[model samples]
Target: MGEVEHVVGMDIGGTKMLAVVFDDQFKPVGRFRKKSKAKVPPEQHINNIIQGALDDAGVQKIRGVGMGSPGPLDPDTGVIIDTPNLGWKDFPLAGIVQDHFGVPAVVDNDVNMGTYGEWCFGEVQDCRNVLGMFPGTGVGGGIIIDGKLYHGASGSAGEVGHMTLEVDGPFCGCGKNGCLEGLASRIAIAKEVVALAARGDAPYILENCGTDLSKIRSGMLSRAIAAGDTQVERVVRHAAFYVGVGVANLINVLSPEAVVLGGGLVEAMEDLYLDEVTRAVNDHAMPFLRKNVRIVPAKLGDDAVAMGAARLIHDKLAS
Candidate 1:
């Protein structure tokens, strides 16, 4: 019997972690998911998830491991420079993973990995240039140029969320005012929805998610939208429009063939969000670029980062 050549891809986010085992062909053989518990050190949770996935897959020999984590991080050195959500600073993530598993490991920004995953295996694989904009707790972005991922000089190039959308906008988590994330992210929308509900304007949100702002989530917003809550629809539309505007700016600057939108909010309210975003792009982008660029939803869903991480390992081994 021959040993199977396998690899592991892990996506580490602010709230959760998912580790997947893949065969040489990049097919998922097994997966494990766990809460990240940001207050706690990440090492134990990461180890448990990877080992659990490997155990479930019944694999012993892994060629490599790739991880997608929040940034700003150094992809080349595999160091997490800083991640506010995860409270990690200057952490040698790749080295720790490699030492723990006795295999080569690579780490990059989570959004970058998701973008790469879509570029390699999702709808935009055929395109030479693409942009991935994901709006979750915060907005994250990734760029693919000339069929390869582009990490700017500091490996933080695709920070679409941090781009200033308004000089006097609300403060963002990144300590910036009027950034796209502050205006368009799910968190931003949730904040608006909660405020409206507190003001007795959004009875549906109040009824479903209660008065606690933290209780309001994307699913609640989706349900409220489906139930004909005008307030939810209005807030979502406003956010989606900003997202589209951001996309339009990217199109004008990068001239990408496609812009992929992903994240919980977009996945939940695809048609409503996409329509508004498309309208914004058409309204704001240069006429020629608008006509040529396609705005699409992400196909890979939660597995996008994992698939991208796997691809990263595969590419490294090949090179």
Candidate 2:
């Protein structure tokens, strides 16, 4: 008799698109997932996923929609300025979604959505200020200040991966050298592991993944570490240390209550990564800042971005 009230949350990544239908209370009612064909226009894929989820949930009334996408985009205007992974430039993602669904739509950086999800529903909910750093194929950062997301003047305040860690370090995906991401990301670590395996230094990796760089995933690396592959452990520890350095700098500047670490690598090698990162932060951070701050792992796993997107729509409607 009454129309089912629902909203949609979408997470758009280079390889996949996930759409979830959420009831008014933020419980997931239905879900749809599809590959993101980078060579094709994103509109159709996005629409298909949302519609599929809605159809599965049998919902007729959608309050709004929210999306988490890769950045260098304008959140204020909900435009995807450029995403190297997807080759989308100057795309009005939110507008397209809104037009298709006939409801309000909001968009923000994927990692920012993850940060918001953690802040609102994950481990950092009680903290007024929190910093989120995720090390995946790349490293991403997000900040919550005074219980609000802080989008800088350019709406890119939390591009912490781009921060220069060395004057002349390895080149980053952003075409810059010495970025934190270049020094310490899953991609960066994988490169080192592959090279070592090629040279016969990491027999475990070579025996498992062969010479294929693409095969050197976080799960594989974690298995190598578990099997006591010293080379893999060293490389991963080094990368985690650099990540800690970046976290230390953020602590010195923002003094957040907690620093949340997430991503595939962190999830797989939680103990190893946490141990190294905790040590590095304590070693490098200012004594005063390190005293009270807690460095923790993200709890939401893969659902963070989607849940955060849903929360964004809810917040917008409430405000």
Candidate 3:
């Protein structure tokens, strides 16, 4: 065998950071992760997190670095154009990392990475076309056509969340009304629980958050369901219904061989919501679309994005 090249894969998000070293076979050799605090500037904070991971792995040289981050980014130029949660705009992430470490770097949207990871090594490995959706702090989507990750014009093609779900529903952080994310995201669910609590129906959430309705989170609703709170179950079902509606629309349009769902919410509550979403898609999607689409849980779990980032670098270099 020829000399092998090691690679570092990093996932950067609003709340946490992770780094992993991968051997030539793409198996993880080592990993590091930590909560991200607010005080650090974007560039320095990312560098520190990556450097910590490098130290933990006890290696200085690598083939290249791959990074997946929350998007609306320019993957071609490796510029994070803007991420509302991360407070980044027009940031040259790949360039800075390459400059600092003297290795090549590639950056892409997290969802894109997730889909690629699944297609390469997870649930969609056998499929030529796949649609991947991640539902957590917000909603994001990615598509693989003919086994290639399609970065549409300006690298903003797979933004399934911004699609309009309701004409005049809740306002999205992107300043749009009735976007899928505005209606079906974790933040949206938390808002609904807070509203219900304000109306005296969220005792569980109130108790969980220490009587502060403002502190209510989606996990509280999940806990309430675990505690047999009928009201929370009802709220969750309603939220799942919207998510189903949105997903059904994607099934109709994309008509991919597989549709994989990921993210914290999906990983934690998939059993609770999967049936509802699947039913909605089967019932509402076009007959041919429904006939061809296979809805399943993503296989990579929390490591999907990071692993996908590593694969992205590998593919880049291999090509």
Candidate 4:
């Protein structure tokens, strides 16, 4: 691993898997993408993805591999304890990658890697402590304390979406009621939008997305709003408001140097999310705690987790 030439960062999400190759300096050289389908053979899929990226980069080998996957997981052991969306339980993801690829591999939570990716390479790099919240298929959160990713007792500490905002608000994918994710995730927003479309309250969504939650995506939602779908816009804003509430609670508890927002929802409707989240943070957060905590959209977009993974394995092997 001395004088490393390159490393591969793999991001495994509920719906997609991406492999990115980066040179020693952390510049992305090449990447590959595939659908994450459990029915397919995972070993072959992983092999194909890594090989494809290596081919794209024209590299015969890599020093190490770093992976980011949905949690709750054991980062130390590289085991995914559970991922409700992916239907994996107690899976030894890191071992499989290390053994199959013939290189050292490290695994961590996907959102944690996204935050670390941004903290290391994006706009918030200067901050000593940072909070990352992403609202997508589901809400995900990450925390960095004193320039390091913070893992709580279970290595799953930064689950801000699980915070109960209401006692009986709505059902969440995590099987909880009134969680912020239940009210504010892209999935939640889509569900409401679908209902609105079904009722003819959202003509754009009705005509385009057609009451199908899965068919409704972040960009489409934005387009619907721009097409004069006021109800759809309202649903998105309401979701943003709840996200801000969760952010306010975290601000009071952690007082992170910065609050960075990422994921599809923020990327698409950034203005609405920024305005609503800012307003809610101002109203709900302690005035002193909220002061100077810059909240902004993530710059890295889709590559954050992959780049973060590359940086992590590079540093880890170097150490």
Candidate 5:
């Protein structure tokens, strides 16, 4: 009865920004991705990125916009209290986009959106409670309770990456000792993998990436492990073990129905992470609490946050 409308969804992170255009049926028609830079202002970057997607889709107008960004932000007011990674503080992200595009916009934490995307369109089935862990440039997490994203009083409820695993472990970016992010993030894994490369324990990484943390991305590490780098495998397994420890703690506390693993690290080395994390959860969690809890890889990959953002805004505006 009415003309079909399209919408844009975006995921802005420390490393990259991705925008996807979705049609009435929520199918992607166009997408664009760009490496993130601290020098670039969010307003400039989002404008270019969203325009890129619109251009690719050959669409002139969109109904609304949705975005996911690194948090300490307010969903109700659309104010970003702070994003250490992006060097943005007290930024009004949703409002900026709304004004720029002349349409309503919704924003949420990137991890929460990613996990919510999984719940809406990924492998999670018939599950009301879920725990999502993503190990990337840094580790992040999200929680689902009774089929809804749980945003505690401060909208930082699902910050599982800050959970301390060891009192005297490596220093985390969060200025803490032995937070899980310091032990399990891609940055942390690269730190140890570099040392191994120097010692010739990981010849593949040494020759391929040359201890260059910037070049040692998740896909590269996975390739190195596949190239007979047993030491690299060991390092990744160690990180997975720590992640498992965190997951174990959550399992004990929340008794979630499913635990979803996503992000660049999990996307590249799904089998390895699954094997180690599953082992750790089994070893540490209570038998009763861990029962019937499915641990699975996220099916959405890079599009999770974007899709979730799109869906969230669509629902929000409809209601």
Candidate 6:
């Protein structure tokens, strides 16, 4: 090609950080990871992660760095406004990485970046308007309209999780009630499972976790559902119903061509969960909106976020 180019893609998660070096064609050259230490100085922690990736790739000239970070980040300014899990506030992540590595840097919400990744190089390429959602420890979303990422006025858009659902339902981590996240996220599912096990109602989940309900994870719940546990199916179906409702609301508003769902919970639950979720969306959404929007799972899996971060840089270069 014209020149050998490389970009560092870093995913700063709540519990861990992963950094990968990708060649000109976006294939991984090497990768590194470290336990996320929130209490550590934000700048120091980010620098360490970057250095780890550099060491793994054994490179001296990094073209650029793109980070998929937890929200809420000021994407325009490359500042991390705050992330509860990372204990960071208004952190100048882009500047820090750029100053340390002598390369351009970009940052965006992890889920948003994941959406970008899918739109650019994954399953959503055929879609002009897309609602990308991730249901993991929490629910987050990113919207792409006309092939451009849409960040609302305050640089804080696509917060599907915060959408009010019941108006007076369970409390969400965002200090709201009846949020889709409150009703349908992994934490919410686990809480439901815990309560059921407490009442001796979820023997299958209990058995999957070896009677220690605390050990029951979203993965175990998936396994229980796969093994045909009614209790597990019930919990998942309830969560899927709420998720579908939330997605339906999105379709009504954005009128996206596709709604791509992914993340740990969606991946683990597999097709059944997605089918139930799509069914709910189809039933609840307006007829026109429901018919026009296609619901599908993200194809990139866990790599979507990191790849999207890398795509941010690539797109910038291409443009």
State the lDDT at 294 in candidate 5. Answer: 97
**Candidate 3 overall lDDT versus native:** 0.82
- CA deviation > 4 Å runs, candidate 3: 1-4, 38-41, 210-215
The C-alpha RMSD in Å for every predicted model, in order, reads 1.5, 1.3, 2.1, 1.7, 1.8, 1.9
lDDT at position 249, candidate 2: 92
C-alpha lDDT score of every prediction, in listed order: 0.89, 0.90, 0.82, 0.91, 0.91, 0.84
**How do the residues 108-132 of candidate 4 rate in per-residue lDDT, one tens digit apiece?**
9999999999999989988999999
Q: Could you tell me which 10 consecutive residues in candidate 3 have the lowest summed lDDT?
A: 210-219
| Candidate 2 lDDT over residue span 8-37, tens digit each | 888988899998999878889998988888
Model 5 lDDT tens row, 1-319: 4564899999998879999999988899999899888356768788889999999998888889999999899988888999887888999989888888898998999999999999888888589999999988888999999988999998778889899899999999889999999999999999999999999999999999897888989999999999999999999999999999999999999999999998889999999999999999999999999989999999987799999999888888788
lDDT of 2 at 181: 95
lDDT of 3 at 22: 84
Candidate 6 per-residue lDDT, tens place, 17-52, comes to: 888888888888878888898567778877887787
Misplaced by over 4 Å in model 4 are 1-3, 38-40
Tens-digit lDDT track of model 3 for 215-263: 6555666778887767868877777777778888877777789888877
Model number with the top TM-score: 2
Give residue 22's lDDT in candidate 5 (0 to 100): 99
Off by over 4 Å in 5: 1-4, 38-41
- Model 5: colliding residue pairs: none
TM values, all candidates: 0.96, 0.97, 0.93, 0.96, 0.94, 0.94
Candidate 6: how many backbone clashes?
Answer: 0
lDDT of 3 at 224: 84
The pairs that clash in candidate 1 are none
Provide the lowest-lDDT 10-residue window in model 1. Answer: 38-47
Quote the RMSD, in angstroms, for model 3.
2.1
Candidate 5 or 6, higher lDDT? 5
